[model samples]
Target: MSEKATLKRSLGLWAIVALGLGYMTPTVVFDTFGIVAKQTNGVVPLAYIVALVVMLFTAISYGKMVRVFPSAGSAYTYTRETMGANAGFLVGWASLLDYLLLPLVNALIIRLYMESLFPEIPAWIWVVLYVAVVTFINVWSMGSTSGLNSLLVIFTVLLVVTFIVLASVQLYQGMGAGTLFTLNPIAHENVQAVAVLTGATIVCFSFIGFDAITMYTEEAANPNTVPRAIFLTVLIGGGIFFIAAYYTQALFPDLGVFHLLDDTLPEIGLYVGGKAFQLIFLAGAFAATVASGLASHASVSRLLYVMGRNGVLPRKAFGYVHPKFRTPAFNVIFVGAVSLLAIGPSLELISAVINFGALIAFTFVNLSVIAYFAFQQKRYKRPVDIFSYIIMPSIGAGFTGVLWYFLHADAFIGGIVWVSIGISYMLFLTKFFRTKMVDLDFDEADRPIGKEA
Candidate 1:
């Protein structure tokens, strides 16, 4: 194959971080702030604090695994390489759930926001338009995708800063909680563990964008840059959420007055900054979702391309990148088609399932770290080694497992059904363990364009 046929390595560290934040959609704090506040009884920031700490452990484990594998397919590749083909196959299939639903979920939310703004148009129109636009940009160019992500992330940051300033001003003028500094948003007279845990689960979704950056494993300029970018992405994105939640809750501490959990932030925007700011906030949110939806769409396509090329899936379609654009053409369109499902379900129900596959995938990533560093490499001699390899990953796995345990029964059963289908397919493909491995070349998967030397 010619050099032009391979994936390009134009993404630098900052570009990767920007891509992760773009996938994360920092403005999401505004969208979910009221819900978290209600769930936590006004201690939204504490939930984010817990979520941030939990994510750091997983981020550390992910950094370790990506350093070991240093290829595409994210958790799928890590678990497969460390555990076995069977484990890898199932994890990859599990990830398929996250990757497939994310774009659809984003589109659904985007459609809702649009419906709120312009009620006359049918919601399907918004979903179709967003799916088409984002799909076209992704298929057209990787540079364009990252570039758009950078712009959107920057705009979101600016909008967040503006909201903070406006909310702070309002608080100083004796509005809402009438104070900027208060333990009320982090902890109160009667903070409950169950409430915090529920909020933590919702906030966990906010941090998964860093993990999604692993989809660009083969495309990063330096593979080592990936781990650093992942850590920074989580911290930076979490910081935004922390700050946003703190002020938003401080501005509107009363959850009973929120009336509409789905559109609470917009109501706050109107209360604190008036109708103009409310519209601007809505625009910022819509933009944030687009950035998120676009990055997620790109990630899932790469996943299918890698698995398809490896014979874990159909080779002719998902495996085939466009000759001119060098993008996963078929997988791109397929994910867009699946986004149509967003139109049927209640957005909240679909959103519940998002965390299921993601949390499971994360728990295994922690185990992958233990499998690689402690068992495979036998590097548990030193205190640092034992801590990083065994202790941290163990904590991460246990924490993520707890979150998975608490997921809605619908998501729990749905996840089981999804995994069973993967297991069944694997059994059929491998003939009950007769074929041990798929012919996947992680090196060939990441083989850069300028490797003549």
Candidate 2:
């Protein structure tokens, strides 16, 4: 519990990428496919394509910002450095809804999986055990957490590949669509603009974790590894989502194929690969939750550590790292404790508000690029500079802004309430806006590995 301790720099590019994929939870494509297909009128792949494009733009902005401010704080650091302390603190606060609750979301999903399989066991038992294991692994060491996460991600990816192969064979043998190549999955005569946009907003949830890669900047083997990892994570993860959505949408051209429209993974598994494969597939889904839980749990703890070290939160509690483990032990355990709330809320209710904070953070990161490069550095004088610093980030901002417009009203309300709380806390912390906020020592935080005392 030493304030002098810092996160160990033990992650390479592949380790960081695996963490990102785990956080994204590739199997989520199946769980959400039925709902998005229904919402998009069977054009789930098209919605995913739109979401991938939108996220790619934001990913580019994230890469650019990380090069300038390569700290574990991620969007919070970028926004604060370029924009101001107040905006950065608020963005970080709003981001807690997305970051903090994600571990609980994973816990909630695992409980659903367990209760479905073992109907006799109490649900809270699974949540407690799952949270405890994830928290302990993260608290133990970053290396072990990454190793376990990598294995889980690899397993889930293999299962997804198997499902696609089975679905392809079924389609070739005169199944739902009877062929692999078709425009129906992307568009048809009945597709509406509003519906696709709404579906895009929903599918954007699958793309959320790509940015979480930025949280490992301080732990990366090289400063440059982070940007490359961010782009790779988004493109690779997006490709998986797109391909899965296409094949799954083709296999079941209509919602009528699924008995449970909102939750179709089990039914899809039962249909595509039958009972034995369904058993294996369900196991993969559970693996995905564990992988995701570890990644999200670690990511939020780092974010909390950065904020705590900066005195935005309490310096002693949130900022302390275990001297031997070199992990933010207090923040990790604190997040695990809060994750116990997973027992009360339904997944649908939590899912509703998750996107609110993500879009807010996404929108600000995009704008932060323009604010820092174009306005602050005057980088817009040249054509290439204009494209990189101005036009690109503008498009990224506009795209996320559109998603914000299409966001559920419930998300808007929840986000506003959270922001109001953050505002009140900020007012009290700053003594009614009279005092200057405490600043982080970037030189000490990002010093080269050999330079650290």
Candidate 3:
């Protein structure tokens, strides 16, 4: 199949924004922050603020790089341009885990929720059904998937807003000096700062998907709109959602009242409003999981397609595009199949594996940004400030690295095992499945007519 025939630019700015927000849905953010809030009382918002600052520096670096090299490979392409093909391949290999694990995590969550509703249905059956439906959506066409995602995004935002509004009403009814505005909840002397930060690092996982917007740049209606969408998605989708969710948790003083660690939905619903709120929150949670599943499936397929195109994988099958749909049919099916198999048995394991891979990938992307900026200092003629070049990345990396250390030993072991698998696969590909590297100049990839390249 020819590259031009397979490539389609169909997603607009709003769609891209929805895509990012849909992937970073409130369920994920709330669940993550709830865990941290339980540990540090109401200080979850502080953790989010710190995470946002850290992510912003990386986002700035990504925004600059996206303007220059707007490709489907995103991080892989960026690393290859600055570093070498080998380093890029390693990053790509590691990232494969991020995309692949996301769908599995979603599928597992969906199964758990489905079982709550239909106790008779086997969890594995629900997993299979969820994967099948999401896979069908992903393979049908990019436009169809994006349209569904847009709808899901709207529903998700409304649900979250409803919860927030209800929570605010409850807080107001409680009258003067409610827990909503009190610092006392988070000012406990026993609360360790490092523990709060560590839990917050885990919470940062929900915000991770906004950067996945870069992966779709090749198909974005206007490539320039991507960075803006990403920024807005992070600010509004991740930032505001986190603030509302954490603030609501703060309004209710007792963390133990919710039983967060044991319950998936957390205590936000019960504390904020009541059963009505809990039901609405449950619906939103389901939608968020499904939306995230769909987004992750789409992204993994695209990453696989890019890898196949670059001859890092078996190009003959994975690189093939549907003659009519112009979509990566095999790649989508493959991701779905793998997700179903991987997540059907163990939800807890799936969550741990997914979060572990995600944090590692996040750490790498931030480090890549620092390296990219440092290398381009002379070419861009930008000020080579020590803070930008060294301090910021060091801080981000150190925090993330510490979080990686704090991950459960089982998760650490699982992540290490996955990384080893990726390395082995890369070695095998280099030895047997390799193809000549394509010579596409990223410098000219997004340039317009008569524009400097």
* Candidate number achieving the greatest TM-score relative to the actual structure: 1
For every model shown, the clashing-pair count is 0, 0, 0
Q: Which residue runs of candidate 3 sit more than 4 Å off their true CA positions?
A: 1-15, 38-42, 145-148, 172-178, 184-186, 218-222, 251-263, 266-271, 320-329, 341-349, 376-399, 431-453
Error (Å) of candidate 1 at residue 405 is 1.5
For candidate 3, the per-residue lDDT at 344 reads 40
Candidate 3 has what TM-score? 0.81
- In candidate 3, what are the lDDT values of residues 255-373, reduced to their tens digit? 55544342346355655667677777878888778767776787778767756665666878877777766778999999988887743445444555566765665566666666676
Q: Give the per-residue lDDT digits (tens) of candidate 2, residues 306-415.
A: 66777778989987888878888999999999899998776645665788888888999999999999989999889999999999999999999898788767778887
| TM per candidate | 0.90, 0.89, 0.81
Candidate 2 residue runs with Cα over 4 Å from true position: 1-15, 120-122, 136-148, 218-222, 257-259, 315-330, 440-453
Which pairs of residues collide in candidate 2?
Answer: none
Tell me which of candidates 2 and 3 scores higher on TM-score. Answer: 2
Report the Cα RMSD per candidate.
3.0, 3.6, 5.2
Candidates sorted by TM-score, best first? 1, 2, 3
Error of 1 at 388 (Å): 1.9
Candidate 2 deviation (Cα RMSD): 3.6
Local distance difference test, each candidate:
0.80, 0.83, 0.66
Q: Summing lDDT over every window of 10 consecutive residues in candidate 2, give the lowest-scoring window.
A: 442-451
